[model samples]
Target: MGTADGDGLREFYSAQQPRLVGVVSLLTGSRAEAEDIVQEAFVRLVPRWGKVSRYDAPEAWVRLVAVRLAANRHRDRSRLTGLFHRLPREQAAPDPAEAYGGDLEQALAGLPMPTRQVVVLYYVCDLSVAQVADTLGIAEGTVKSRLARGREALGAALRSDDHA
Candidate 1:
């Protein structure tokens, strides 16, 4: 990357890190993991900044990288869980009940991965449909469908919780 690219990337990093972390945390359900993912994304982005900075939205690229990394990590954990089944699992640290609130958090947690990603990227991260499509490398129609279904699922989940 050129000196100009480095300077631009530094400015972008300062502006976008907190927002990126927020989006990743919403997806991964762990703030610490989210921060790590965003940081790693930034690191990966730096070397490619010359190319990526020319994009219409470089922040979108960073977000896509972080989200993809988080998804890969999730898959790796699932695979490892099967291989390590015989090993005792460590207890996770407790989360504060109010850290992410109640019904909405529960609703989001209940969503399937694709829909959850769509919802978080579209709604929480405030990305446009086209932007989300580009970020996920999916069709715009797919993003719309996921967002629609995700909203339906969230509404149902919340309603069920209310009834209970």
Candidate 2:
């Protein structure tokens, strides 16, 4: 890659690192593993800078890649659980503040995959319904429906937490 391409990649990674880490962290509870996933996502992007550059939504691609990799990490952990004698640290979820703090974050993490994906893209990332639809390769109406359902679920979860 030329210096210009290298700079562009650096800029892309720099701008996206925190959001990618946050997404991965939600999927995989380990802050450490989340960082690793973000690194690997960027590594996956390096070779395809040409294609990525042409992509109308490179961030969407990165988000999807991170989600898939996180899912794979979960699957790999489950598969190796029987093979390993020791318990995995990633399997041990972090402690959250039971009273007030981290409640919303915990709730979001507990949601089903589709709801979580829609919620994260629409609420957390502030992506529009159409943008999310494009990212997930779904219809705009589907995005709207999912967004409504996710919002309702999240709202209920939050309300319950509040009343607790």
Candidate 3:
């Protein structure tokens, strides 16, 4: 890449990295993994920067890649655990939820990944239902249903926590 391209990427990285990390952290429930995933996504973007930087929302591309990577990691980890019955390693990254506060993060942690993905993209990223559906490659109806379920689950969890 040219110096101009490199400078543009540095600028883009400075602008988008932290937000991407936060969003991915919510998705994977591990700030450390999110950092790695986001970094990988940006690294992937380096080769494609010529075309991607021209896109209206290049960050969307990076976010999509990061989310998919997180999902893949989750799946791979699940399969390994099922096969070996091993405990998960402790992550050194600070809890992403701690930034938002404990209760909501804990409630979000209880959600299935799909529902949590829908919830975070819709609420935290402020994406439209159509946008969220497109991002996750699910139908709009599926996104709506997942959002509904997420809302109900989070509400119940938060209320119970309040009472306790």
TM-score: which candidate is best? 3
Model 3: how far is 161 from its true place, Å? 1.6
TM-score of model 3 vs. true structure: 0.87
TM-score of each: 0.80, 0.73, 0.87
- Cα TM-score of candidate 1: 0.80
lDDT of 2 by residue, 1-164 (tens): 99999998889889999988987676666679989988888889899987897788788788888877776776786566545535576665443333334366677765666667777778777888887787777899988887788778778878877886
Stretches off by above 4 angstroms in model 1 are 1-3, 82-101
Candidates 1 and 3 compared by TM-score, better number: 3
Number of the top candidate by lDDT?
Answer: 3
lDDT for position 23 in model 1: 84
User: Which lDDT tens digits does candidate 3 get at residues 1-164?
Assistant: 99999999999999999999999888877799899999999999999999999999998999899889988997896686555534344533344444443377778877888899899999999999999999999999999999999999999988877876
Per-candidate Cα lDDT values, in order, are 0.82, 0.76, 0.87
Q: Is candidate 1 or candidate 3 better by lDDT?
A: 3
**Candidate 3 lDDT:** 0.87
Q: Is candidate 1 or candidate 2 better by TM-score?
A: 1
